[model samples]
Target chain A: MPDLGLEVLIKGNNLGRLLGGLWIAIEISLLSIAISIPLGILLGILMTRKNRLIRFLTKFYLEFIRIMPQMVLLFLVFFGTTRSMGWNLPGETAAVIVFVMWGTAEMGDLVRSALLSIPRHQYESSESLGLSRKQTYFYIILPQTLRRLIPVSINLITRMIKTTSLILMIGVVEVLKVGQQIIEANRMSSPNAAFGVFLVIFILYFVICWSVSMTARYLERKWS
Target chain B: MDFAYIERVLPLYERAAALTVQLGMEGILLSIVIGLVCALILYEKIPVLRRIVMIYIEVSRNTPLLVQLFFIYYGLPKIGIVLTPEVCGVAGLAFLGGSYMAEAFRSGLDSVEDIQRESAYSLGMNRMQTIHYVVLPQAVSTSIPALLANIIFLLKETSVFSAISLMDLMFTAKDLIGLYYKTTESLALLVIFYLMILLPVSIVGAVVERRVRYAGFGT
Candidate 1:
């Protein structure tokens, strides 16, 4: 039948290059995750506060992040800022910034919802038990909130990982970019290299994200 | 940002925005149809089709739309199934949007009570009639918020259309910047055009959600 061009994947150092691209994507996502988690927790706590200005500001932040496409954010940071602000920002660094911003907003919202979901009675009972405010949070609220947050955070982690694929647009040599490079190099030798390379890249993304999501599902089921 | 440059480029952004809306709408409509069919198949537990739909949903949901677009636009030509960039863009959007829409509709379908179906049956209604007259109304009403959110999401996702060489808003902004190096003006206009497109939708979605919440239809 037709040449599927699957052989291009195993040709020379192509497979290794693809894997290296995957690692770069993972590197950006992992960096964003490590930074956003703590900052997001703080933002989430602030979200649950009763202060009017704080609530409004946090809500605005969340809505802004929600409305803007991550692609635009990436472009603004990578292309716009370097020229406008006169700062030499690399694609990887710009990606981290945008991702951290997006991730923190998402994670903060998750935290706020988790915190709010704790029954009012739990708080009332905690207060009546004469525990200090800090102690009440430490002993009662944190545990429940953490339990609710873990599965969703894991899901967000997978989302972050998947979205890292967009970084390739800003000229970052992520996995998708590397796949393109391989396809371009093999264009003459393998007429169908694009199909084969993209298919493999798709599988790589699927495997990583599918495993991460499965873990989240498992946690959700185990806890529920 | 340069005011003169912004003024001159306004028409271009406007045209790009119109195209973005057009393609996004086409994709969203197609996706809604696809999603409903998938949701119905899943809800009905239609044997092998149900398993296939499940696989489709998981695969679409897990993968980024960018890669899917690349495959459709670049990869498929190898096998003689070439599609235009615009078609590929819309197809990619629909492919991803379909899974999400299916999820929203499936949740709505699941929320329909078995008792409602039994009552409909007792009244001499067939399965199809019961689903059409009784189940869909309530399920759709409850699913309004989710469907609206998905619509907005799908609209925002149109930004990625530029990657495939579609002259959408993102493409316009990037082209202007590349040609003139007016990065701030191009990006500022990009943000404004996007806000002009999305903000109204967000506001309208909220209003519709509120209206549906109070309408108490099917409840």
Candidate 2:
């Protein structure tokens, strides 16, 4: 507060607005992740399928998502879709759509790599034990995949949270947008409002991600 | 299916594509330098400085690149430091790339065993010689895939430049859209332009990763 002198957050309704913005960011990220993980995992597993067509389609989607920026994706879903398809989606809905799409691709890639990291001998041993493909995947491969996947997938969660900030560009009134509004409102009295607001936003982000990473470390050890 | 508008905008797209490449490459190179320096500092492990470096890495990594860009571009002026959009965009990207690159570099350096250093000393190599002749090549080779991937990620991220009017591919696409209002077709073209760059880099990334793996620790 001394360095930033942002106590004006207490003087007006700006505090509530900032908190509400944080809440919306959290809400969107949480909902999107909830929706994405299961579907992404399925896509990841299906990516490893022996069917050439399945791999081809999954690869196409992954490559598309991988190369494109999330900002562009946001524009595509928010502005492009409405312009083209006449769906007239809300900004928040468009934000969720973009996050879910991006998250699923990221998580799918994580799952694929975790699956790839399984030592070949493990699969061989399972095959030698007369396990069917489904049994091998279910009883053998999946548990290890999940264990490896959990630690790495924590990365995607934190990443989604951070990327949610970009929703502001698409006119979603998220935390950064809230900070902007706060600063704009008080710029006459406080020229340094943005400095304080961004510093706080940075701290909030650090805390959220730091805790997530700590839990990831704990899970890695626990699973190990 | 419709080429008239795309044809009209082709020159603008080409100019923006060139600028994107320049920005991305410059950002990538600077970040590699920053990452190497920061990683070395972290490796040497000064107490207070190490703590500061860790905080920088964590804050940069945890916060969104957009916010970082905004802070650098918009918030800095409040403190009487003004930067052009191009400068801010590139620096912001460098910071982002540098943080991740530092992580990769540290792990790469750490993977070089102390025993290797000991062996180098036994072979009459000095510290610098050992690091140069033994450690760095091994470390760089092992981490090449990660380093390349981060560069690609950074390149993709430069699309955020569109927001700040940095005149990159996304910016050009936005201009095209502003003119023609063909959001669907033009945005797809934007993605295509990115794909043209990224897909080959990724293919090379995969090839290098496999060769590095097959070549083993001698690499």
Candidate 3:
């Protein structure tokens, strides 16, 4: 086995760089979530509209988002926009845009499913109880949908974090990108840099996602 | 959209799209085999083997697939085991998909009632026969929708192979974008190609999903 550089990353500028990259990943994910949640809720509601034209358009958008890979979406926004409209987006901004698009679409789907899963009788009960339309949604429907949304949304967040690793391909200096730079930097002195650095990164990601999943389960229990 | 450029590159896009489908199908088969093997071993409760399979499933599930691909493709070379990008891509997707499939199978198999196994054994079925005659069929049926969903997911995931420099559809788009320097046409062609392949399957998936889903709600 080759020598390990586990020590090299534990202190100094290397650690800082890795943490900064982690921050970028977190920033992009959180920002995208903030944007997507409301938009996704709106999209989900619009998708359920009785208007045929509006429903058809929303379904087409949802299907289009569903079928394409997130990476392709990133490429579309990053290169396609730059070439076509000259947006000249930075890598981080491009990552955000693509992730927001994906997150919104995914969250919209989840909301639609959650809303669908609510038994029609629950809506009828609220109506029979003389609840207003807005009151019915706020009191009975949205809460149930939000409960189902919690675990799935958290799952999506983990996915968003994992997918953010691909942003390095487009030149965003996220955690995976930092690992690459570190591995490339000490390639001579530390032949096992790839193994060690990536192992740490992998463990970091695993712990976060595992905890998120666990919390999802916990919330499921608590809410139920 | 640049209509003329897109039309000119239609053949190139077609070839690339074919490759993407090939990889996706290969990934599906590979994942199913791994999933079945792992699920069976875990189901049978092999001593140390079960733990090893569990570790493989968890690690693959928890970590990002991009990192896994990088570790295998780039990291392994340092230890003198170099692999082609295509090999790395398929292997990575297989491992990732298998981990997911194993979870699906595990749950599906677990949900199957124990009485069926008892009846199978009582009917003079041996251990293997019991699995073959009774448990396996139920597990497979329960898991079919999840498996099909995985196949579709794996198909979309083939795009990630582009990160490893695999010449799947996404890389073809990336290369074309670099070559033509006209993003809208090349990128749009990529989307249309994927849509052509995935749309039909997704529609079918939605119908099956609704049937399976509502079947659960039968009161």
RMSD of each: 1.4, 2.6, 2.7
Runs in model 2 deviating more than 4 A are A1-5, A116-141
* Segments in model 3 whose C-alpha atoms lie over 4 Å from true places: A5-7, B1-4, B207-219
- Grade the docking of candidate 1: medium
Please report the candidate that would top TM-score against the real structure. Answer: 1
User: In candidate 3, residue A59 scores what lDDT?
Assistant: 82
The weakest ten consecutive residues by lDDT in model 1 chain B span B210-219
lDDT of 2 by residue, B167-216 (tens): 88877777777887888778878877888878888899989988878644
The residue-by-residue lDDT of candidate 1 on A1-224, one tens digit each, is: 77777899899999999999999998899899889988888899899999999999999999999999999999989998898778999899999999999999999999889889999999899999999888888899989999988999999988998899899889898898888888888889998998888888888888888999999999999998
Considering every candidate listed, which one attains the maximal DockQ?
Answer: 1
RMSD of 2: 2.6
lDDT, model 1, position B138: 85
Superposed by TM-score, candidate 1 places the C-alpha of residue A223 at a distance from the truth, in angstroms, of 0.4
Query: Looking at model 3 chain A, which ten-residue stretch has the lowest summed lDDT?
Result: A3-12
Between candidates 1 and 2, the one scoring higher on DockQ is: 1
Q: Ten consecutive residues with minimal summed lDDT in candidate 3 chain B?
A: B210-219
Judging by TM-score, tell me the better candidate of 1 and 2: 1
Give Cα distance to truth, residue B199, candidate 3, Å: 2.6
